[model samples]
Target: MSTETTLIKQHVIDPEICIRCNTCEAICPVGAITHDSLNYVVKADVCNLCMDCISPCPTGSIDNWRMMPKAKAYSIEEQLKWDVLPAELSAEELAAAGAEVGAAQEEAQAAAQAAASSASAASTASASGFNSAAYGATIPPWSAAHAYTNLYGPKAAEKTITATVTGNLRVTEVGKQDGQQDYDTHHIVLDFGSMPFPVLEGQSIGIIPPGVDAKGKPHHARQYSIASPRNGERPGHNNLSLTIKRVLEDHDGQPVRGVGSNYMCDLQVGDKVQVIGPFGASFLMPNHPKSNIVMICTGTGSAPMRAMTEWRRRLRASGKFEGGKLMLFFGARTPAELPYFGPLNNLPKDFIDIEFAFSREVGKPKRYVQDALRDRAADIALQLKDPNTCFYVCGLKSMEEGVVMALRDIAQNAGLDWEAIGGALKKEGRLHLETY
Candidate 1:
């Protein structure tokens, strides 16, 4: 078979930086993105360079592109197997590989135009649809601190930083042996010792599980949200905390253990674990004074919320800063299932306003986080209009649409312009959604 001479700019995701958060997979209009338990990849034939998945990515990994011969473009299969992106081929190398290097620009532009034309008609309806992922901002707020990412990564990662486990405790009550939902989450503390792994409030760390997959390759890194303030999990120590749920069952109600979550939950205090990244940029909390935060979450999604709240609490305790209102809406099946239930309540009422929704109580009516949002429609409407108030929603994938729709409904009922409000949220980095 003969190969084509024209070169095409291939859109690829950097697996090293990607957190497997599912944002890109959700936002890609043409279904170009897909993922397994390992990595997320873009299909060369399906991807049209539509660029819709670029901005909503929290880690900025989806913005990478490589010029390659169209006939020999990287396939989704090849990409999913990569631990790191292949180095770019030079012009001479491209020509030697049966591509016309000089025609790269012309072919790239043509592909882009065709993609735009095909996606144009659907864009209008997509804009009108209520996609929470669409409203997710790709940048941090104006007052957010400088977050450092990709400081250390794969490729010579054997020499990368490793942290010692200092503390491991169960935060939630023990569930029944047969899954009665009593919160099987653990609070794990990792001490970097003398090494520097600077992470922000919303940033995540990639832990390489000490095992291989069914394919016999090393298990890819799993991302977990940091659950402590940036200063340290314990004050003044070189440590951080992670809230990890022991995955005993798959989403299908079958007995299937999660490789990464189980490995993390079972670590001992003296164990050493390989770590990489301090991934994420756009999901960071604002550092300026008097900036409000509204957090809505379910289950272990409360990890990042804990980080931001603790940081603000520390600042308030120091008496050096005057922080604004902090409101939290946390949902769980029962009180015992909620991680940090005791600590979250122990926070001063004057310092924070919290709402809890329990849907599976024995006798009470079912209530979800969205129902709580509607119950506080008036207050939420006010916050919706406040520029200083940043709204963050993190939880299961199923909760994303309902929560975003709740926000839209609140805006509409208040006689506010939802179009303008939603647009500003994306443009000004006021809304962040991180559902797995």
Candidate 2:
């Protein structure tokens, strides 16, 4: 490909919709995608329009494309400074940049053909390195109830909604007195009085912290999974809950506090906060009769899992729906570190099959969520073949790959073709992964 001679489709990230989840950056095969603390940008010089990063992105921010002469494509430096995407180049500008009108059209067609070929190749790849889009569901499950999304936030014409902090309680048992590490996690409730902010299980919302960043720019929003059921945290009210962990250090071990998490955790009862989105359109629970749910999660990833579980519990209590099996495989460093440890135990054993894996418990061998899944492989394998069964995985980013691999192994060992089953899982919206 000539660097400056041809016209091409340029990939760009929409900073407005991006939650800075790092999904696009992680999945990009070429080193074309990079991000700072504030933005994720694609280097036009490096991107081949492979589309590997598109479907993995929870938000469709990475799906944007603009046509321009290759030489006129936005540089990485320019993209990093962008708060919003620049307008597409005009036809006259494209012609003036390099090629004439006829030649530009020909080149653009060639580029489109090349992108199509790359996409075809991606679909036929081996099951071991499968395309995430092939096996990741974008639609809510068939029986999922109608969910209200984007009632507030950037996409909404109205200003962001405000919610009162109804409650904030530390969920994790951390401290020297407890003989555990000094890490803290909080379960928070936000009440949206008289606001029509309806949400389903497995959805997330963004919180815009009350101040500017160190650069004196307005702080961007941070997304957190909704931990309460659709009805409300306390049932039949306009409220929701969030599971937030205080971020005292960056991923690089630097002592930089997280802007959103700290602000949320430090909230007092009756304090109001700006909120946006009931974000995710997918990753929802199936509402059909006899539908089984298998939830796997670690850390705060348990937020959405808790929502689904609680909703199922509520349904069971109402005696209106004949629910199917509900299985949970949760992992943490210790029982003390697990959010909702005591409350989870209080759930009736017959209602949900719950297993806890503790990796760092003293005098116990390390066990991950995958380990628990393997131990219960036969049950999970049966579920994999069942059309009514749905699998949800959330939590730490590190757990995503392992959990998927374990699912693959289970399917194959059960005498099923992994590729076919994986495709069906996605096609039927039976598998959902939401890791950060």
Candidate 3:
């Protein structure tokens, strides 16, 4: 058929500097940016010139620039694949090239059609669905093919940034408030500026140390959610904090060394180490005003919860945050492993509702966070009545099934259908689960 020309732009992405975090690809407004193992590039035809993809790039690897005029303008085939065969190439080669181009055009057409139709239709809501919009399957604001490269022409990448340990990385704060022997919580403050590391609240980073396991293989990186809010650190400088638990060895009782937690806990103030990331987008907390938050977590899963809670606390302290209620449900093994136990308890009861369940506490049967949730079924049901409430669940990967069951039960006990509420939560991006 025919093609229409949109604005021409280039993404200046420097592979050297790019962290390959995929943030640019994740935030693209159109389905244009794509990548192979080596590089990420923009599809000229699909580029929308939105330029929204640049800000989140940490290394500033993305640069949007207009195509220069009077430059050597080559056809798509020539510009893309500079090394060309003679026009006398075999018929088979010509046929393959033609077929490839035809396939690409067809795919683009299909994507465009999906975008238009999905935007107009009502999508099905389901627990398995990524977004109800996908039910209708509309073109998402961001897609796998879309990337930040469209606005900024690709450029040379800078070196990937890494966290260096240079200062006192000791456990500055530890344990619960009021001498609660019930938990093993610790608020560890790492001096990043002296060590000079920096991070954001919702962002996560990897922790690793030099060592091979008993199996003789080097350990892989471990990602941890940053407990401190972005602003908590200086604009370009700050301290990092984490609430960690020392995991028990295996069921066999052999001491299992945690790849990250053990390394973090073992560090002295003067020790140096390697750290990477601040990874995750789906886990980010909404910063909108009047937004309500429902946090469901167990153990160190409370890391992000702490970040969100403290951010709100800071805002409230400024006497300007007049927003929705923040409900927190934290769980741990026998209460001894629930980090931030004391600070969480000290929050004004009016501003937050804290619920705890000790899954392994002695004489009584084990009561998990899910059980606590069941007890508060009425409260959860009422709070969920406000569509604005965002629900977050985090902790051990194994706890997911139990927590989900608890949510379902909470729905059933409240006289509301689980499927409907669950679907609504997913559709509104209110229900978030982070484990493993």
Top-TM-score candidate index:
2
Show how many residue pairs clash in every candidate, following the order shown: 0, 0, 37
- The order of the candidates by TM-score, greatest first, is 2, 1, 3
Q: Name model 1 segments beyond 4 Å from true.
A: 1-6, 15-19, 55-61, 69-72, 81-100, 113-128, 177-183
The sequence of per-residue lDDT tens digits that candidate 1 reaches over residues 185-246 is 99999999999888889888888888788988677677788899899998898899999998
231-304, model 2: which lDDT tens digit per residue? 99999999999999888777766666788988998999999998888777778999896999999999899999
Give, for candidate 2, the lowest lDDT window spanning 10 residues: 174-183
List where candidate 3 sits over 4 angstroms from the true fold. 1-186, 191-199, 212-218, 233-237, 250-254
Preferred candidate (TM-score higher): 1 or 2: 2
- Among residues 3 or more apart in sequence or in different chains, the pairs in candidate 1 whose N, CA or C atoms overlap within 3 Å are none
- State which candidate, 1 or 2, has the greater lDDT: 1
Query: TM-score, each model?
Result: 0.90, 0.92, 0.60
Give the poorly placed runs of model 2, Cα more than 4 Å off. Answer: 1-3, 26-32, 45-60, 101-106, 123-134, 155-158, 176-181
Output the TM-score of candidate 2.
Answer: 0.92
Candidate 1 vs candidate 3: the lDDT winner is 1
* Two-way lDDT contest, 2 vs 3, winner: 2
Model 3 lDDT per residue over 167-205, tens place: 322222344423432223344554444433444455666
